[model samples]
Target: MSLAVTFAAIPYRRTGVVEMSDVGQVILCTLLLLAIAVAALVVLKRKGWLARWLGGSAILDQAPAIKRIAQTRLSRSTVVHLIEVTGRRMVVVESKSHIRMLPQDDMESHDPNL
Candidate 1:
């Protein structure tokens, strides 16, 4: 009996690793993008570009009717206020989720629990 052996051929090429210049380019691009975004934010905050875009003017056209008389802070973001509008006084409650207005006749500021 006779046995024959043969080796299969392999076609492959090894490539070089990434160069330092390529890494530097990537870092430079990232820094440039971050700088541009920071600059845009600074410009928006300082120049009030967004306010101008939303139709805000530097001058007041007329006086407001709602006047704040007094305020009591209930919590960090919650407040109760006494306000007068058009000679009618009322109580207003403000919170992160809701704003409430109570009728003038229903509110008693002298009450401690109020």
Candidate 2:
């Protein structure tokens, strides 16, 4: 039996400096501005001034439109059954042609009798 040893050569290359186009610079600037705007908005939101200017209660009420649609659509197609185990844990079974399990920890917690 003969044993052979093989050696591989490593490859390296020098990289040239990159020159960005006007569009690339504009995009980078736009992204920076967007980040700053988001930070400002977050600060304003934390201070409650954003809510005051935007009519926060109205916005919150309107935010449920999509959720209401989803719930209505799902309820029409799926049959929902609830089972309470104890304390703040409940199992919600949604069955259509198939059975699906859902945990209702928050729901049970909010229930007055729970």
Candidate 3:
């Protein structure tokens, strides 16, 4: 048995620096990938796959518990919504600090224009 060991040093040369076009290309590629990922995620979420992954109990056989009928912004931090649950329609006032039910007749029959 014979073993031969040989080593040769390779020469190195530096190239030109990265151009603005290169940076723009990288940024555009990154944004395109991100947009694709976001679109895919939206599709998955709408189809309830993401909900199943998150253990949200949303299944094909069952319908959603609450349905939003209408919504109005009361202020910057407050909102009023009309929602349907089971078979009842109700108005709900929601703020950052509290959530409470409102009278539908009072909200609808009482007009601010008067």
Candidate 4:
């Protein structure tokens, strides 16, 4: 047979172009896999199996080191908070752009004014 006839006799193969249906199927499968993984994590977390596997206490069980005792807003964008952290009480001033803490001496001086 001639080269043209031989080549023509071979089966036609489509190359390079991807169909929308094939893309949709791949996306669907990826979403299904992710959903299953998330569900498994949720179940394990509820059962505390993940904590045991990681060999430590779950982070949520520990008591917080910093606690907010009181807070007051000076204006719409500025706030003052009385907070306790690591057994030390302090005043924290927060604005939209900055945060600052008063010293212990300042706390003593300001205690009676509040």
Estimate every model's Cα lDDT from 0 to 1.
Answer: 0.83, 0.61, 0.85, 0.86
Model number with the top TM-score: 4
Backbone clash pairs for candidate 3 read: none
- TM-scores for the candidates: 0.41, 0.32, 0.40, 0.54
Model 2 residue pairs with clashes: none
Off by over 4 Å in 1: 1-18, 54-67, 73-80, 84-88, 93-101, 105-114
lDDT of 3: 0.85
* Per-residue lDDT of model 2, residues 18-103, tens digit only: 54556688789999999999999999989878897887857754533212112222466665555444433344446567776455
Q: State, as a TM-score between 0 and 1, how close model 3 is to the true structure.
A: 0.40
Cα displacement (angstroms), candidate 1, residue 87, comes to: 7.4
**TM-score, model 2 to reference:** 0.32
Q: What's model 3's lDDT at 102?
A: 61
Top-lDDT candidate index: 4
Better of 2 and 4 by lDDT: 4
lDDT of 1 by residue, 2-113 (tens): 5887779885656547676798898999999999999998888688775666676453334678899999999999999999998899989999999999868777546757
- Global lDDT for candidate 2? 0.61
